[model samples]
Every structure is written in C-alpha cells, then in structure tokens.
Target: MNFDAFITCAVTGSGQSHKKSDKVPVTPKQIAEACIEAAKEGAAIAHIHVRDPETGAPARDVALYKEVVDRVRSSDTDVILNLTAGMGGDLILGNVESPLPLGNGTDMAGATERVAHVEELLPEICTLDCGTMNFAEADYVMTNTPGMLRAMAARIRDCGVKPEVEVFDTGHLWLCKELVDEGLILNDPVLVQLCMGIPYGAPNDPNSLMAMVNNIPKDWVFSMFTIGRMQLPYVAQAVLTGGNVRVGLEDNIWLEKGVKASNGDLVARANTILSAMNVNILTPAEVRAKLNLKKRG
Candidate 1:
C-alpha cells in the first residue's frame, strides 16, 4: 500500500447530473470557483469538463474552457489543471439494427477539433481516454479509435502538456503500452488513471483493481477511482493497492444517501479518510514534482 497519495477532484463531468443536484457547477465561474475550493481543501488536481450554462449539458466550447482556466490560473490558490479531451467523440446509434444513421447526442469530430482547448489553453494536464466503450450502457458509444488516439496523443505531446491516460478496462491498459511503445507518451513516469466500475469497464473490486495494477509498468504512476458510493471506498482501496485516489461531484455527488455534496466536500472527505488511515495526502506542489508536470502559461 502507498503510504503517501495525492487526491484529485473531478469537479464536473460531461454528464447530466446538474438536474439531480444544484451543487454541480454549470457556469464557467461556478466551475472555476469549485475547482479553487477543491484545491484549497487538499485536492492536488482538479479534473475539469465544461457544460452549457443554459442547458446544463456537455460542451466543447473553447471559450468556456478558456474562462475556467483563466479563472483558476489567476486565483490565489494553486492546483494542477486537467482538462478533459474525451469530448466530441460521442457516437449515439439509433438502434442495434440501424446504427449507421446515428441519433441524438452524437457529436463526433476529428482528432484536432477534439483537443482544441488543449492546443489553445495548454493546461498542465489533459485526459486521453485509452479506449472507447459503450458509455453507461446507453445507445451512445464513446468512440476513441486507435488511429484517432495516435493522432490526438501526438497533438497533446506537441502542446507541451501531459496526457493522463484513462484506462477503463484491461485492454485499454495494453493500448496505453502500445502508445508508449510507439513514442506517443513521453513522461518519465507515465500518468495513468484507472477508471473502474464504469458500465462494462473494469469492475470496482480489490481483485479487479489489483489485476489492472499488477499489469501496469512498474514505472508508471497510476490513480484509481469508481463511480457512486464506491467512490469513497476506492479512496482507501486505491492507497492500499499502492495507487492514488480520485473523488468529487463528478464521480459521486452523494456524501451519503439523500445528501448532496460539492467538490470541496468530497475532497475534504477523502483527505479525512486518508488522514485516518495514516496516509499522507499530497499537495499540488508535491504532486507536480512527483508527476514532473510543468505549469503552463
């Protein structure tokens, strides 16, 4: 088990969770403020995703991303910024029989367009989903093909930002190696986030987490997280598995059943949990040095 771990708060995701809780930040100001709050509450990194302020849906608007980044960068509090480049790859099929025409929520795009924010803003880190999956068991499929991934990884490298490889299943981990082998990933200790318990991805169990962790290259730095209630438990599970932890309203909004939580609340809880277990919760500066990330302009 890793005695020292860093906490990442995924502030808001590309999901329609605002309807369930008003605490989920929608506007850029709110999102930025929440990120700052999480950082102040002991979160080393804030994984960000923007949403349409009016509609409260996922968005790929560069302007929105810029507003959030600017807000955070100009703030007194310091936190590692990680923008999601996993958008604009949605392929919502009409049905199993008639999948060609596509349906609503399908905002697929080319690789360059997908990473527009990273190119323009140059966040310290951005997420590169290792592989695609039938997201949430819905008709929509998150499409990240190998060729597209190669192109995207190359672009992220060019921008002088680190890509946090997101692995949903064991196969995704293999693909991550392939990217590294092909010279796409260049970090000394490659950053990887094990996205467990999402739909048909890797299950949120100790054995499953260990299976994925055991296979990872010894030098790679990995963090593990799960959705809903499993989110908190994974905090301990991840540290015990010799990995880091992730939490926030994005993965799980409930501090408890029928209780809503903000990004700060979740981060504070994870810090409390880690403190109780005698684990050292790392700071942003510590995480930056450990991950070898350069703060961008």
Candidate 2:
C-alpha cells in the first residue's frame, strides 16, 4: 500500500457536467478559482480543462486556456498545473447503416494542432491518452490513434513537460509500455493515470483495477480514479493498491445523494480519506520532485 500519495483534482472536464451541476466551472475565471480552491484544500495538482464561457461546452481555444493558466499562476496558492491534452480527438459516427460522413461531434485534429496549447502554455504536466475506445455515448468514440499518441508524446516531451499517460484499459497500458520503450515518454519514473469506471473502458471492479495496476511498471508513478459515487471509495482503493488518488468535478459531480460538489469539496473529502488512513499527502513541490516536472507560468 502507498502510505505517501498525492491527490490530483481534475478541475473541469470536457463533458456536460456543468448542465447537471452549477458548481462545475465554465468560464476561465471560474475554472481558475476552482483550481485554486482545490489547491488550498490539499490537492497537489489541478488537472484543468477549459470550457466555452457562453455555452459551457468543452473548448480547446488557446485564449481560454491562457486565461485559466494565467489566473492560476498569479494566485497566492501553489499547485501543480496539469492541462488536459485529451481534447480534439472525439469521433462521433453516424448511424450504423450509413457511417460515411462523421457525426457532428467529431473534432479530430492533427497531432500538432492538438498539442498546440500545451506547447504554448507549457504547463508542468499534460495528459497523453494512450489508446482509443468507445465511450458510453451510443455513436461516440474517444479516438486516439497510436501515431497520434506518439506525436503528441514527442511534442509534450519536447516542451520539457511531463506527460501523465492516461490508461483506461490493459491494452492502453500495453501501448504505454510501447511508448516508453520507444523513448517517446522519457521520464525516468513515468507518470500514469489509471482511469476507471467510465462506461466501456476498464470497470471499477477490484479485479479489473488490480489487473491494470499489476501491469504498470513497478517504478512508474500511477494514480487511480472512478466516476460518480465510486470516486470517494477509490481513494482508499487506490492507496491500498499502492497507487495515488484523483478526485474532482470532472469525474464526479455529487458530494452526496442530494448534495452537489465543488472541486474543493471533492479534494477535501479525498484529503479526509487519506488522513484517516494515516497516509501522507505530498505537496506540489514534492510531487514535482517525484515526477521530475518543469513548473511554468
């Protein structure tokens, strides 16, 4: 079991969670506030995703990202910034009978275009989703081809930023290994996030979680999280399995059945869980040293 772990608060996701809960940050200012709040609540890192201010829709606009990053960097609180490089790979297909043209939600982009924000902002860490898979949406697929992943990884590495490899299944983990072997992901103790319980990917079951955990390179650093009610429980599950923890509005919006959660609430709860277990929560500086990250403005 991991007695020393760090919590990563995914401040906002590229999803419609804002429609479900008003607490989910939409504008760049709101998103920056959420990250600062989480940092104050003991989250070592803030995994951020900016949304359209007017529509609350997920956006990859560099200007929006600049606002969020700028606000966080200018804040009094200190937290490791982790920007999402998982956008621009959505692939929503048409009806099964006629899959000729892609659906409206398809926002695929070239590797360079996808990593443009990362290259520009140069966050301490960015995510690199390792593989492609069908999502819960009937016609949508979270598309990330091998070539695209390699290109993105190379670019992220070139920026002197750590790539938090996101793995949803065993195959994704396998592909991550391949990336490491190819030296595209050159971090000595590679960082990985084992995303669990998201519809069609790896389930939140213990066996499945262990299956993915067992395959991770022993020296590599990995954190685990699941969506909805399971998010809190996975804090313990992840720690007991010798991994770190992640929690925030991105993956789960509810603090309880009837109550909504802000990013701080989720981070606080995860902090309580870890405290009860007598685990040490690492600080942003400690996490940077552990992951060999390059902090930037």
Best prediction by TM-score: 2
Reference-based TM-score, model 1: 0.98
Cα miss at 76, model 2 (Å)? 0.9
Off by over 4 Å in 1: none
Q: After superposition, how far is residue 133 of candidate 1 from its true place, in Å?
A: 0.6
220: Cα error in model 2, Å: 0.3
> lDDT tens digits, residues 1-297, model 2?
999999999988999999999999999999999999999999999999999899998999999999999999999999999999999999888878887598887898999999899999999989999999888888898999999999999999888889999999889999999999999999578999999998899999999999999898789999999999999999999999999999999999999899999999999999999999999999999998898877776
| TM of each candidate vs. truth | 0.98, 0.99
Residue 128 lDDT in candidate 1: 98
Lowest summed-lDDT stretch of 10 residues in model 1?
132-141
Pairs with steric clashes in candidate 1: none
Give lDDT tens digits, candidate 1, residues 1-297: 899899999999988789889999999999999999999999999999999999999999999999999999999999999999999898889888888788988899999999999999999999999898976655888899999999999999988899999999999999999999988998577999999999889888879988999999888899989999989999999998899999988889899888899999999999999999999989888998999999775
